[model samples]
Target: MEDNDQRLQRIKKLETLRQLGVQPYGTRFEVKDRAGDLIRLHGRKSKETLEQERIECTLAGRIVALRRFGKAAFAVLQDGADRLQVYLKKDLLGEQTYRICEELDLGDWIGVTGRLFRTKTNEFTVEVRSLTFLSKALRPLPEKWHGLTDVETRYRQRYVDLIANPSVHEIFITRSRIIAAIRSFLIERGFLEVETPMMHPIPGGATAKPFVTHHNALGMDLYLRIAPELYLKRLIVGGFPRVFEINRNFRNEGISTIHNPEFTMLEFYVAFADYTDLMGLTEELFVRLGREVLGRTVIDYQGRQIDLTPPWRRWSYHQAILEVNKLDESVLRDRSSALAAAKQLGVEVDPNAPLAAVLNEMFEETVEPHLQQPTFITDYPIELSPLARRKDSDPTLTDRFELYIAGREIANAFSELNDPLDQRRRFEAQASQRVAGDEEAHLVDEDFLRALEYGMPPTAGEGIGIDRLVMLFTNQASIRDVVLFPQLKPEK
Candidate 1:
């Protein structure tokens, strides 16, 4: 009823405006000043100073607050960045302009010609000489609704949420700065930014189910890329020495505090660099971001002070599992023993599951939660890393490391597996797993394999989850808070 009344009131005013030979919806106005810039530049000027200068300016914004008296009134205008007070008096303006001001609504957009002055209370304000109605808002602002507290409405009606909660603007602005900084950092290091395909003929990058669609003309099924790893690596084979891509990846996955089906990633590859070299680069990148974004190496995330200083703690995959669970080497020596140890540790696993999958699950359950500070768990088992290079001393383990911060995996890096023969074997192994009910297993991309035969350089590649990184920097508790429009189910 309130909304309907607002619409009717606006219509009545539109007729009144037409009768007065006024354009309710106005055209071009030469806006000479912004509220924020004016406040910043001349806010300190005294009442006498403003009166002496007689500074004339034109401004435009939405009417967020208004107050009316017998023949005098005050209205607060909210511009793009800040708010300023505008005093409208009928006696100074005769009666026609004051009537136009009276016709104004809370959410209406207007342009005003005014002079700067200090209010009697010493507040900096714009004394309006004339008002031009620009646009009429049908519905009112979300004044009565608690915009931030209601998650469903907050995400659903983001426009209203933004107006009701002014601080929400900072979150998106900070996210933009983070991405721009990443691009600048990589570009300075001779990394060439490139674009990759979002649709793939076959999903071969990461082990995640894909969202598939069909191309009508081509008459073939295409998968929304779960990751751009494969296409980026193809750039390596094409002789691009250094490349980086920042884009969205889609996956058919369940929603959670840390997981979003569609999210952005920063993936980069460098030739002649191993996983160890990339680790040091990763530390430097975060430390640089820390000083640039927050002006310090320490950040408060979810009530914990996370220090991103260099030389973070490192642990081998097997070592972390053993120390966290206090298990003997013999306990995880073979499939049966590892299965028994898992059951004893209360980590459930399918009895028929491969030992590699069970052992990985054990690490996730027992060790990941304790990695609060910046830590790197390295040298994953061979079966778990199909695209990573094998370690020289222990071929059973691959040269890969996953960086964890605040008990969540923020980045994953590895030495690329450039040998076509070995990569083919690993792809076959994953295909077998897929046949046996593991839908999230990698598939053999013959084109990617053939590209491997063309010989890619020994390179190090890494993917950093941009969403989770933004969450930590912004002090947001959930992934939804960082994402502008996170995936959500329809209203029932």
Candidate 2:
């Protein structure tokens, strides 16, 4: 039978109750106690003893299960903690209330004022003195044993999903705690939290395409921010020594199990600190949060134990990549030799690609998945880091690192570039890439360049993917699982 047809029949039955001088949809209900409290209070009492005491309490919940046996009826009502059985008998409730019980269906919201007692079957229950309908649910719940299983519908109708599966509610609850912990951790460390513009005339944070929108009145085009990196640096130039922002970042890119179109990102900048300090901070924060949130430093993410203890292993990006490809680190010094090594190791190398770009591609395809534990892969090639400060010992590399856990990049940090001249040169190089048809190349933000001319302090900055971190802490498999409203493909 059609679901709506069934709902219509229930609605008609509910209207009949109103016509018979009973309010089917009540305006207010004063619930004195919860179902769980009632059960706990009466579980130890003897049935005969409780029947003599007749403890009065009022409770309201959604009707989950109902069974009618002529004069007597039992209905399971679910409150927040758990469900409790409510017994209705014609002998006790009289014919008028018994008639109302016959019209009540599963999924309707109801209020029951009753005496706490134990049933003959050793079950704790509420023996009703009065019953009322708080709200009439026209539609029935999905089946008792089976639930809403369609993935698209689950995401679209999230409220129904929350009602069907209690675990989904816990996931989002943990997500909020994860973010709150991050903010608290940072604020406690003397970091000033700030907000930056979401729409920018030039998006220069990271290498990614941006969602473009036009301002009709102003006759100008703006891009949704890919990262808050560049603007946060501008704040540093304006003399905010320690700052961070927990905000939404939109990326016009592909979505996957680990990637979302719009996601939360935590960007922080520390003046005079380096990537090394930031690494220590990241490790300590995760370990502390693990102990605080889940009561353990060891988290099981997708069946792998991720230890967030201090002193996470640090390896240079090139070193890790070479080990994955079974090549010696010495081969990384020469471009031609590196290409030859890649070929010998069966790794694809684009001849025209920059050396760092080829190496990064190889690492992502080969080594990233093997970094299953908390580890920092540091010292990336200069070609891959336009905003990072060049290492003094080796100008060919940048003072940067990325934290990888469970095969995904969780955080990116670097000793930020503060020299205006060097910054301009880097932007010009990226502009050249743009001219060569690289759509993902960074744009030259003139204001950011102008801010750098004011002589910003030496600073270290990091951007952590908040959704991915929550997934790790919550033991969720996909980014969508942690995100309440993940972007999805529109139905045809």
Candidate 3:
């Protein structure tokens, strides 16, 4: 039914109720107990024997269902956790109060003062003495079979979704628990939680397109941070031994089941640590979180069984590409060899792109989905990881690892680059790449270089995608499902 039509009808009903000396909207009703707690408290007793005790309650909620039988009636009232049946009789409530009960609609919120009892069918119920209208719900809730199913409407009217589908509330509850557990885990390990600026003049943390806005007061263009990597590292430069930030990070990118334009990220840095230490920490934290929050080391997502137990399998980028495509190590030396192999394997390659980028594309297309279990794909190509410290044995590869589960990247960590000269050169190369039309390229932040020159301690930092992690824990398929309000296209 149209909302306006229902509202008008309710207004007319209110006038009728007033004429009968009944208030259609009430102010307050003090409920002595919650539905669930009361049920648990009297669990052992039979409903009939319990109701005979003459228990009293001032319960209030929306009337979910109503059945009328001439002078008597039974209505189901839904409070927060559970629903209870309330019986209203003409003998107990006089004619005027009985009339109020008869005129009450299914969606109306009412407060009932009653003594608990049982019916002939032995269903525990409240024999209401008097009823008061708490609020009038003019619009009818959607039918159970066809509740608010449209994605756009569900996001736009999130309150309706939360009301109609209890599971959505559970998902968000679990999401909050996951974040809380992470904080507790870190704090127990002596890490201080911190916050960094969301707006930046030079977004040098990661290679991603940034959402730009003009700051009128500052009279400069400002960009939302895609990652808090640089600023957190500057903390290390200033001698904060351990710090972490769990906050929103905005990225101007394509929206998909796995990617959201704006989402929560947990990025933390630890001085005197490397990717190896961070990897161990990541494994420990995830396993602990899964067990503590979910009460299991294993969870099923879609059709795959994911085990979040620690000591996740680790593979180097070179080895991953070789194993997935059945190419030997000898064939992966340079651009020419990798390009020839790429063509032979039907994998797309960018001729002008760096060798590492091409290999990454191949791995993403061919190998990522096979990583259904918790796995750390380590030793990424140095070119693709400009800010990461290179491996001592292999200058071409960096000490970086991406944690993957259910074939999606969940966390990324690296031994941070601390050499000022080397960082300057990488930034210059990134600037050149930007000039050559890569909008996602990094910017050369002179301030970050100055911090590096000030001699920041050896540090390792990692970013965990909070939305994706929540999705995994909640068994939600789309990133939008976890996000309360995902961005959508403008309605035309």
Top candidate when judged by lDDT against the true structure: 1
- State TM-scores per candidate: 0.94, 0.90, 0.91
After superposing candidate 2 on the true structure, give the runs of residues whose Cα lies further than 4 Å from its correct spot: 17-58, 80-82, 88-98, 144-147, 330-351
Write candidate 1's Cα lDDT for 1-492 as tens digits.
Answer: 878887888888888878887887788887999998999988999999999999888999888888998798888888864788989888767698888877888878888888999988999998888878888777777656434568887877777666666677788878898898899899999999999999999986898999999999999999999989989999999999999999899999999999999999999999989999989999999998888877889999989999998899999999999999998887556888899999999999989877888888899999999999999999998888999999999999999999999988999999999999999999999999899889999998999999999999999999999999999999998898888888999877
lDDT, residue 38, candidate 1: 90
Ranking by lDDT: 1, 2, 3
**Candidate 3 local lDDT, 1-492, one digit each (tens):** 486777788778878888888767777688776666666765456775675676777878878788999999999887763678889999999998898887777778888888776678877788889888777766666665125687777877776777666568778888999999999999999998889999999986888999999999989999998888899999899989999999898899998888889999999999999999998899889888889889998998987779887778999878988988888776567887877888888888888777777777778888898889999999998888999999999898899999989999999999999999999999999999999999999889999999999998889999999999999988889998999988888876
**By the lDDT metric, which is better: model 2 or model 3?**
2
Give the clashing pairs for model 3: none
Candidate 2 lDDT over residue span 1-492, tens digit each: 778888899989888889878877789788899877777767788888888897888999988789999899999888863688999888998888788888888888889988888887978888888888788888878764226677776776676676676678778888888888988999999999999999989987899999999989989999999998888998888889999999899988998988999999999999999989899899888987898789999999888899888888899988888787788776676677777777776778787777777677778888898999888999998889999999999998999999999999999999998999999999999999999999889878889999999898989999999999999988888888888888999866
Pairs that collide, model 1: none
| Global lDDT of each candidate | 0.89, 0.87, 0.86
Pitting candidate 2 against candidate 3, the one with the higher TM-score is 3
